[model samples]
Target: MEESKEREKEACQELPSRRDMISNLPDSLISQMLSCLPTKEAVRTSVLSTRWKTLWLLVPSLRLASHDFPDYNSFVSFLDKSLDLYREENSCLHLELVIRKDYDDDQCCVTRWIDHVARHKVKHLDVECILVKREFLEAVPLSLYLCESLLYLRLHRVLLVGSESISLPRLKTMRLEQNVYPHEAFLQFFISSCPVLEDLSIVRKDDDNVKVLRVHSQTVTSLTLGFEPGDGHMLYHYFDREILGICIDSPRLKYLNFNDDVSKCQILSSFISSSVKVHLGGVRYMSYYSGGVVFSNQQVARSFFRCISRVKDLVISETIMKLIYFCMKVEPLPQFCDLSYLEAKVCLVDVEMLPALLESCPNLNSIVLDLTRPTIITEQITAWAVPQCLLLSLEFVEIKCCCKAELVGMKLAKYFAENSVFLKKLVLRWRGYVLEEDSVLRDLLELSWRSSTCQIEVYGPLKRPVRV
Candidate 1:
């Protein structure tokens, strides 16, 4: 038996080795594959064989993070050598470079690299420079605004100083997060220069030096505006410097996501499309009087709602729901004549307001409720006037319990099951820790649904099987 085993091992060793199929692929395909990897890891492929030695330099994209290296000097050296080789050997048709790091060593290093890439006709560039101290922010080179080859650009925690003649003709998507612009006109000019821009996202800080942001692009299709509160000592002065408002004039706009607590108002106009989708959250008004903060002013809230009343899809946050509930006391919500889909995040105690909000969307077809933060039920659920959509257009209803199961959520579910006339599917999802899982299922199963053919689907915790 030992002699037979030895003969078999010898025969296997005598067989030819397997071919390296991956290495045999075309250099263009191999470089494209390496482009998906980090620049450091891509460069390490050089040691694989002589064929791969110079292949990484041909990669169309480079993602460099300073933390990936032991020190800043090594990172700089690698960038210098790699980019030099790429410029000499590879075609400049497309190049993407992403740099994310805290560059405190030499501020000029970042600007120099950006200018170099801009000159080389970079197609995509993402730079996120985190500062150790928030007092000083590095400014992007003026040359970047003139890179006509750029298609996508994302900058975070940088200062954008506009030039007299800013030109990025091919730019399609741009994101500016926590960036500092010199003034409001500079920002408007910066955005107007991108003639073919389609998507734009801006995350404002408390002291971004822009009071009233105006977006006046005729070609933009999607826009997202959000706010980030200051930290530590800056929080003490937050209430003193709230943003006045935002004005948008994009005629081709299809989507808008507005999430800002500081902005007092939002004005949207020139919307030619009636099928716009809107996501609203953290919109409120706070007044500082007698050394205390008070939230009031329903007029601002009402105006905000009216601006988005024509949207086809609406997603409202819990804070905005509370504001709407209070605003309803002073004035009624505008009719959402075109709204068909609604997704709302509400607390259990605030579920009573859901029907009133739904009544405004007369043509609603689907509703998704994200229920959370349950409070003790002390009073009966308020009787709501039946919404027009519930009787005619409502078809799909989904209730997601983001927290532990509660009687209020079940009651809301029961209310929908019995009220929605044309409902086709009712979904109930909850966590597994609730001891009343079986009881909840029994109650739902026994309820008399308004729709004769309504289908009920129950989902428990992911660890457990689905209970129909």
Candidate 2:
């Protein structure tokens, strides 16, 4: 009877658990379910039953973030075991490691993890290793370039030091941040190898070796490049003498964004696509520098504006507006014959530059001017020939101005109301408190609208500003 009871117990254990529908599913499906969770939670499946014990090992993706581990040694041990146990022939891997202290042992462990992923067929990889030290630059493992199966790769704060040509034929999207390439030419060499790459983003810090960054990708349709202050470097480092120029030579490029101090860099682009959208900014430096530094940026400003002359939509930041103000004094401004939409950020000093810019954009349909200063000398409105947009094409005018009094607001409203002939709508946004609000409204209403169809909308301190 005891022997019979033992046989029944064995049979009951082999049967599926009560009310369990998923556990009895095929091994491949179970592994697929486990792969979606973090590696820590995925490992918990081993306790479910004997069949599920080894299923976590077959998960097709391994994600190990440093914060998931209680301590560094636990993180190191967990990564070692996961990679060793990962039985899937082709697995996708993602790692987000934060190195608060610069330690060589942690870096070596990262190298080992990268090596293991490269040997396996890693299809999609995203690794972000943040080196918290001010002077440390993390070295990316060379095996990363050998992973031909990688479809998307995004790396941050990693140094690419080798002279080897990085060939990843299937990569479609790539992002590199604070990556130290040995030379500027290495940046081009790395990009040229990816034949079908579609999207690329590069954020560079002050590099000792890279004087000029020339992005020459034929396949990239979208690109975003920015330069900002690094850990030990101040914002002034962006305008240092060591960094010289940026050249963009992509013929198929349709969209571009440039965020940096224009004072120090020369920008040159090959215009193949006549219509592109461009945002040029990083003008905050103007408030701090001496007059001599501002004077030197005139040529730099001219080069940038000339490059974007072919764009249809243009947004110029306050810094860029100041640059143009300086450039206009030196050279004849380039005409933006194709430009339709114009948004400009201007201070009291830059307001003088507007008529010239507006004259250049003969076909501008809508204009949004963001006034940076709270007050302007309305009496000193420099004379300008009537702009082509004011007479014919311009239908809408939006002004974002800040003021302590209503009179300061009236000066800008009166300028546009008097000029725009075919204007359909006039919108004025007052950012701060406007004293004598009703009088300001009456004054705006009293201003003569050039077009009979023009509608006036004014928002004061009590109301939220309208979107331009």
* Cα lDDT listed for each candidate: 0.76, 0.72
Once model 1 is optimally superposed onto the true structure by TM-score, how far is the C-alpha of residue 449 displaced, in angstroms? 3.1
| Model 2, runs deviating above 4 Å | 1-71, 93-99, 102-106, 132-136, 163-165, 229-231, 234-238, 283-288, 291-294, 329-332, 373-385, 401-410, 430-443, 455-468
Model 1 TM-score on a 0 to 1 scale: 0.86
- List candidate 1 segments past 4 Å from native: 1-25, 48-51, 88-107, 132-135, 230-233, 268-273, 283-294, 382-384, 433-442, 462-468
lDDT of 2 by residue, 1-468 (tens): 999999999889877655367877898888778878877798887998787787887766766677666766777787788777766553545444443323644444656676678767777776676654434655667777877888888777667776575768889989887767778888878887888888888777676357788888888888777774566766555445453688887878877777776666677555535566777766466532564544765666667677778888888888777767777777767998888888888876567667787889998888888877655454555254578889989888887776653444467677778888988888877757654456666777777768888877777777643322
Give residue 189's error in model 1 in angstroms: 1.9
Q: What is the per-residue lDDT of model 1 for residues 47-140, given as tens digits with 9 covering 90 to 100?
A: 9889889888887677777777877777778777867777633533343444444554543466777777888888888887664344556678
